[model samples]
Target: MIRPMRLVSIEQILQARKLLEGVTRKTPMEHASDLRSLHGGPVYLKCENLQRTGSFKIRGAYTRIHGLSEEERARGVVAASAGNHAQGVALASSLLGAKSTVFMPERAPLPKLAATKGYGADVHLHGAVLEETLAEAIAFGERTGAVFIHPFDHEDIIAGQGTVGLEILEQVPDVETILVATGGGGLVGGVAAAVKATRPGVRVVGVQAQDAAAYPASLAAGKPIRLKEMHTMADGIAVGEPGKVSYAHVADLVDEVVTVTEESLSRAVLLCLERRKLVVEPAGAAVVAALMQHPGAFTPPIVAILSGGNVDPLLLLQIIQRGMTDGGRYLKLRLRVPDRPGSLVAVLSRVSSMGVNVIDVEHSRISGALAIGEVDISLALETRGPEHCEEVARALQAAGYTVV
Candidate 1:
């Protein structure tokens, strides 16, 4: 339960903005040409992915560390994170001339782990998941007399994140709606407070991965509730529970919260790469996912916050591969053909005739599904898109080849 206290005020946010003037970059708000006419209004993207440490995490991390009393600062700091916050706290503590330790899950991506260590944190790989890692970090903090930098639950963190909201208002003075990617709600809550305080007429919508959403339930219950399960490709925003401090702000100020599927996240990431030439992580692309899945719901003059860009390279490759499949450019099909020698050649010829590139082909006659005189061929092909996939499918079927 959140303790009753005065909420973070505009004065505090403004003060944070002033403090961060030189510490953080005022990230760009680029107009999204592809979405300009959405709802007959212009759309823009708040590109926080390009921020320091490849995420908005640094803003809060820096603020929280900087706010520590001089005596407290002498004791150092400790934090736990899946990736982005680890890097943020590590980098921020380094910048402040403070000793820092970060606990990360054993399964945390290599690039993030390397980057966090690179930023001067004494990194520990301690647990199988973030929650377990977090517990260890807190224990370490208590053991060593170090300050625990709560990732998204502290007032200072919220205040620092609110600076992004201020930047958005200034960058797009006439913006009508702001769509933010939410995890523990730090970024969105801070943004909502700043945006709604100054411009209550503007809509602030929060988007979360459907597989790990907690905000909707928390809001409905009027308190933070821990989810029983959490899973998603967007690991950055996959918090299973909403933060008490941030949740209060989000529940009161955010206009609505929505969720998007894993497929939408991949498509959104692909769209960002293909159209905007920006490399956004799945969590950062949650705003785009919501827009793609629910374009009609938003009024234009909008800005979608691309919250981070710390995606692991392997995950990115997988998302791209999956995105291609989802977009109908890649296909996998299994079919039974006569066991005769010419059968494989015939299928390859038909596929080639339609200008489809065969990525791989496998045939087996020993499968349970195959008849005595027939072999099953599984083909992975690359086509132009949905229309071309259909054309290829029709051509193969027309050639008396059964596509299963």
Candidate 2:
């Protein structure tokens, strides 16, 4: 049996704090009054989204790279990540004067890829997925004698990440439940070990994207289980299998693992943006999504970790638009009307009378099904809310146009 490394100790996590001192930010524990009231608990947010490299991964990367033997550091280092981890390792290795080769998936977000390269690491685009990219990194490390830096599987990495748990305990001493988004389980595993080892009463719950709920399945099987495929909008937490090292700690120390749906994740991201005025990536929002769906699970003070904020600008725009659509802020309706000058004015007047903001109006005579003298028009409007949307639709319907 290849026993996984259980070398991480509470003392190590505490020790890492000093090593990581002045390197990683002591991320804020934000008090979410709305979420706290809604969930009937004091909800504090560990805003790692504001941490160095825009994530908590910097904590682990810095700790691991700093602890490397001088010989190993001279030999260089290599790791693979989707984005945040890549930046962390790239920045850490650069700071330590170590050469770095970071392998990222071909379809990895361009902004992250560009940022990784910008951090002075040699960026290699390999494989169609993260798993294949990681495999390539390992092969490269073995061939060149470069030290392989495991993102969440190595003992030093886990201890470094465990520092986040330590900080959370110090910031929110009375916290009852801590929800962390889990991918390969590195962040939660480290936190779970630290929390369980110290504050044993605090429940550490790991939340995974439902599309990639490998940990829960692995737990059921009593071993790490690999998935055939993963499909989720929250790509950060889309690991197919738990890390061998992380799996052991999570299984032994984590209180429970839960899954959140794509819809919930999107809504949570939007809530963070619109209400909290914070920009959080989908993976980072998984913890909040889990809490929103599983209210009353925690008693007084519940802390959710906002893990990262490295979303692509394009994706963020799309998510915002989709969220607006879901919130009844943007609406599109196709209607048929007679081809006349007064037709548009009549529809516009009706919408205006209903206090609906007319963002765009397009009269398409070329695409839609039109009667001999009638034209189909597509109107995109912005409304106040659901009730306003309903009023807009009703007003358009009463104007004798065929509203679809």
Candidate 3:
């Protein structure tokens, strides 16, 4: 019987830190000033988004590939990922002077696919989800004599990811809590073991997108459990089933696992973009999302990991609009007004007077909700926020226009 690699040792994690000293970046842990004042305590952000391959995945990927035997390396390696791991393995293989092949889902972001190929790896777009992609990758590895590199689950991978925990301890010795984005549980489980083994007093938390979370259920069941359906904006962490090996460590070492809503994830990403000037992907911002949803839930001297910045540009545009809508900074109003040209001008005048920017305006003369001579007018406006949106709504109402 084949055994799964479990319980990554702190010593292994420490060794990984040494191996990764020059291979992977020692990502900086900086203070979060805005979150600090709100929480009345120190809050730091571990900017792993700035790491090579745009994520912490490279740490493990490099470690795993580096540990392969000379003969094994000669046969090359195959791996699968939604995006982050694909790039990680590709880069790792290239760095180690080994051939690499990466399998990614068809729906994977274009930037990731391009980056994987750019790193000198043969890229194959297959399957619709990670599970299917992973299956194809494993099959190809078997047929081609290439070793299949698991994205997470191996002891080497965990040890490599645990280097982040080591860095946290070294960078912020007084840190009381650490929040990490959870996907396959590689980063979380590995980091948890490293931190708990060294700083027993420090709390390590895992944040997952609620829609696609499997950790909570898996933890409850005392084993890895698969979700029937999973969907979330944080595609980086959207694993239907938690890694068995990673789950073992997580169940034993991780302090708590929390879930963040899609809306919170959107707002967190926007906050990082607007306030911190960081373009954090949804999965990377899951820690921020949790903190936003539950203020004061964690102790001070907290550090949240910004896991990756690999979001598709097209998706980022939609996320920004969703964030604005959720924050009440974007408003859409339907009104029944006279079809006269001056009536449309009057509405625009009121909006301009209120200091609200008009994004779009459309006049519908034949709407079912409108009577004869009454046109259904739709206006999309940008406001300061919820308060401004409310103020503008009242002003429009006061102007004798029926708003629906």
Candidate 4:
């Protein structure tokens, strides 16, 4: 039988805030004019992306580790994470003079792995996914007598993460709706508890990646349900299940939980990069994605948390390209032209005349379906938007070129 869940209290969160003083940064809140324009109300970003260890994980990690008795501290701490939590635990343990052991997935990003180790943790690579890695870490903790530092689920962790909610309320007193990126529900649950206990009027929404969302089903069942498989580029929020403590808080306190598509996530990342000059990871951009995809779904004076900024550079490049394509700023086309030198020039000139920038061009005469006297040309063009892309395609077709 499942034990009754104990919800984190606002008083506990306040105590956690006192413990976190001088240990964590009060990350800034910035106005998002572009999101405001789309939302038709004031919008702001809680920039936890700039927090210590590059995420709010530090708040919970430090608070939890600090609560341990002296004897437990001497035993050290062990944790499992793919990225953010590992760095948070490593640094938190180091600051508190405890040895930390962190187990990460085999395919965890190189930058995150390096950062975790740099924070003085004994790093171990295990398993193909987070679940397997977590198993190994737990076993290690049990065998070595080290304290198992859970990334979420514990009341202390929830209380610690609740500090973000306190900071948000203090920063934006009149904020109506607050959107938070959700994975295992720790952050959202803590925020909801704090906000509800204090204001009792603010609406709190949790945003999850659609492909890996487990909260909706779990909430429907009124229990934490484990997913057999999960996949999403927003790896930070790709948890397979919610912890019981977090589930209790979410079910009781949060106003709503919503999911955003991968395409919208990419577009949100692009918007933060190009428009706001902020480097937000896909998970961190979930709130922005929700606002952009559903314009009127939220209330005015919204505060969206930018959960983390730890992203692989290679993945960033791919997301940017995908974002451009999804936003209709990039267009790819194949056309049939005469097998002559002027054919390429003619197409380029026609494209340039319409103010479209040609990113790449490929000409091939060898194709299974190409006629004897014809060549197939592939073009990668950039345009202003969807309308411009359509105009460019139509103009090419009208210029007597077969847009294959």
Candidate 5:
């Protein structure tokens, strides 16, 4: 069975603060008045989404890299990550004038790859999945005598990430609860340690994408467990297993861990864009989603960490479209109508009269649940929003043709 989390001492946190001097950014702890009022409590946001490389990964990367001996630094560094961690390590290594190589999965986001390259890392695209890429990085590190910078799973990296917790305590003195997104548990483990050490009563909650939640299962199994397969839009936290060191810390310090659905995560992404005017990746939005899903779980004066913002432009566009659809701004429907010449024109005229802009329309006679004398019409329409969409649907229903 996994032992309870060991409380990190205040001295350890102090040492981490000193070691991280001039390295980590003092990320803002801003009062999210809108979110607070929406939740009927005080809510603060730890804006690590604005941190260097667009995530808190830099804190750990710098701490781990700087802690290396002269010989290790001289030999250079290597790491594997799909997004933020790759950029973090690359930028940290560049700033330290150390040679760096980053192994990324083939499906890694283009923007992350670009950012890693921009930070002067030799970017190597390998493997279809993160596991393959990480395995390749380890092999490369072993063969070349270069240091393998793990994304998490190390004491130094965990301690480094703990700095965020340190900043939160200083910035939000009354913070009763802290919410963070989790993957391999590094950030949550580190943050929990720091927070619990500083304020013994403060609750540190971890969130995970529902599909990739290894922590919950690990906690049940009493050890870090691996999943046979996992899938989630929050790919940043799509780790199959919890990190050993991170699990140890979380088991003791974190108050609890929760899982969020993909739908809620999508909405949270929209929430950040619409209300907070922030661009957040899916994994980063999970914490916000968790708070919204379990409203009464946290009391007032809570802090939610916005972890990263390194999303691909194309993926961002798709997410925006998905959000719009989810919000009822876009609608797709299939209908059956008489297979006659004026039938298509009649449908268009009816839809246009309702001010619904037709985005696309398809007519098919061979493939749908249409009678011998009828045709199937599929349409994609743009409406003002959900209300307008419902209005359009009502208008269509009122027409003589049966609406499906």
Candidate 6:
């Protein structure tokens, strides 16, 4: 049976805010005109991605570490994370004069590994996944008498994260709806508690990557349920299960929990980068993804919390390319053309005539489907948009080119 967990109160969150004074930044709320246009209402982004340590994890980490007794601090702290939480714990421990040891997945991003170490944590690369890394961290804490700082389970941590909700109320006084990117449910739970306590009528929603979402199933069952397998580009919110404490808060306070597709996430990240000039990670863009996927679902004056900005550059490049492809701005096609000398030039000429820019071209005559005198021409083209992509394909076909 699942153990009962007490919900975090607004008073506790207020106390946490006082404790975090000068420790965590009240991250800015930026109005998103582009998203506002889509929803036909005011849309704002709670830019926790711009917070210290590049995420909201610092708030909870500092609050949890600072609450530790002197004797507990002397014993040190241990944590496991793929990235954001590791840096938060490392920095919080350093600030609180406590030694911190962090265990990260073996395949964790290089930037996250470097950032965690940079924050004065003794980092250990362990396990192929976060679950294994968490086990190792717990065992280390158990054997060494060090306190294990959970990423998002404890009451203190939830209270600290709840401070963001308080700030949102102050920043957007008339806000009607709030969307939070959720992993183990800490941020969403905390925000829900704080928001519901003050403005009982305001709606609080939790957004998760569809592939790694656990809350939908868990909430339906009235308990936390562990996922057997998870996959998503938003590794930050790719939690396999909901924590008991967070689950309790979410069940009681949040109005709804929604999931967004990977395509929507990529588009949201690209949109933020292109329009808002913000570098948000996949998990951070989950709220925006929800807005894009279900345009009219959210109420007006919506605030979507951008939870972090710690994505790898390589991954960012791939996500941007995927976003472009999904948005129909990029098109890839193969064509069967005569193996004559001017065949390649003819194809390029036809494509260029249509105002399409070729990003890449591959010419080969060794395809199994190609006849003796035919060559396969693979073309990667950049177009204006979805309509332009279709027009390009139609133009090629109209020009007597067999688009394979």
Query: Best candidate per TM-score, number?
Result: 4
RMSD of 3: 2.0
lDDT of each: 0.91, 0.89, 0.91, 0.94, 0.87, 0.95
lDDT of 2 by residue, 273-346 (tens): 98888899999999989888788776668889999999999999888777677767888998988888898888
Please, what are the lDDT tens digits per residue for candidate 1 over residues 224-248? 9999999899999999898778888
**Residue 283 CA displacement from its true place in model 2, Å:** 1.1
Estimate the overall C-alpha local distance difference test score of candidate 5.
0.87
Kindly provide the TM-score of model 4 when superposed on the true structure, using C-alpha atoms.
0.97
lDDT by residue for model 3 over 1-404, one digit each (tens)?
A: 11445588889998888988878888988788889865679999999999999999999999999999999999999999998999999999999999999999998899888898998999999998989999999999999999999988898999999999988999999999999999999999889989999898999999999999999988888788999989899999999998778888888889999999999999999999998999889999999998888898899899999999998999999999999899889999998888787998898998899999999999888767677888988999999999999899999999999987
> What lDDT tens digits, residue by residue, belong to model 4 across residues 154-204?
899999999999999999999999999999889998999899998999999
Model 4 misplacement above 4 A = 1-4, 367-372
How many clashing residue pairs are found in candidate 5?
Answer: 1
Comparison by TM-score, 2 against 3, better one: 3
**Candidate with the larger TM-score of 2 and 6:** 6
Please, what are the lDDT tens digits per residue for candidate 6 over residues 16-45? 999999988899999998888777899999
Would you list the rank order by lDDT, best first? 6, 4, 3, 1, 2, 5
Q: Which of candidates 1 and 2 is the stronger one according to TM-score?
A: 1
Name the regions of candidate 5 deviating beyond 4 angstroms.
2-8, 30-34, 335-355, 363-377, 384-387
lDDT of 5 by residue, 225-277 (tens): 99999988888999999877788887878889999988778878888888888
- TM-score per candidate, in order? 0.94, 0.92, 0.96, 0.97, 0.90, 0.95
- Identify the leading candidate in terms of lDDT: 6
Residue 18 deviation, candidate 4, in Å? Answer: 1.4
Per-candidate RMSD vs. true structure?
Answer: 2.0, 2.4, 2.0, 1.5, 2.7, 1.7
TM-score of 2: 0.92
Q: How close is candidate 5 to the true structure, as a TM-score?
A: 0.90
Off by over 4 Å in 2: 1-7, 336-340, 364-375, 398-402
